[model samples]
Target: MSKHPGPSLAQHPMPWWRSGYLWLIIGLTLAMLAGGVVTVWLASQQPHAPVAAPPSQAEQGGSLEPAMQARNRTSSRNAKALGTGGD
Candidate 1:
């Protein structure tokens, strides 16, 4: 028999914070964090891929130009109709 009676694992359970499993969890967490940082750095270092340019207003025809064109056509048609009916 031992001179000093020490508490055995069977007698008292070690708290989770004092366990080897806790260290493993901490290690895995740090590893994942490091991986994420490295990934972000690598991504930032690379040049961005070219993106398609959006359609421009001038290329699509000016908005004001289209509205003005529509107004002119409607006015000319009404003038012609009124002229023919009144005669």
Candidate 2:
């Protein structure tokens, strides 16, 4: 039997540009690049606000009371367990 040459490139049914998948990928990539550019532009246009200074000791009055009480309670429990009476 004689061998057939099979389909040639000139006889191909559809070219690469006509593919829907290729166009979709290209569109998504362009969209992603545009989004990145917009994000960078927005960030550069708006300067960050200055960070607020930590509250001073005078400004923090009774906020630490509960924490201090918990620490004291834990220390007393440990001291009693060790028979040191928390010195």
Candidate 3:
């Protein structure tokens, strides 16, 4: 046996804070959180207009009767016949 008897250096575990993979994971998590915060802030800065309600049936002169249904059916049929619509 050798005269010197000390613990081997290879048996030591690295500190958690010194790990590259751990730092990469932490950086990615922070980046994603920052991106989410920025996205929310930007969305909040957008213009939010009040939606307008559609005219009432009486105000539209009751045009949504059988005529509108017939026109829609005819248009859909024409589109399908022309191969411009999904079958």
**Each candidate's root-mean-square deviation in Å?**
10.6, 4.6, 8.7
* Residue pairs in collision within model 2: none
**1-87 per-residue lDDT for model 3 (tens digits):** 769866676778777899999999999999999999999999899678989899898798876678777888899999999999933
Tens digits of per-residue lDDT, candidate 1, 19-76, equal: 8888999999999999999999998896788898998887887677887888888888
Candidates sorted by lDDT, descending order? 2, 3, 1
Q: Tell me the whole-model lDDT of each prediction, alpha carbons only.
A: 0.84, 0.90, 0.87
> Which ranking of candidates, highest TM-score first?
2, 3, 1
lDDT of 1: 0.84
Best-matching candidate per lDDT: 2
Ten contiguous residues with the weakest lDDT in model 3: 5-14
C-alpha lDDT of residue 79 in model 2: 97
TM-score of 3: 0.44
Task: Give a tens-digit lDDT track for model 2, residues 61-82.
Answer: 7477787899999999999999
Error of 1 at 1 (Å): 10
- How well does candidate 1 match the true structure in TM-score terms? 0.39
Extract clashing residue pairs from model 1. Answer: none
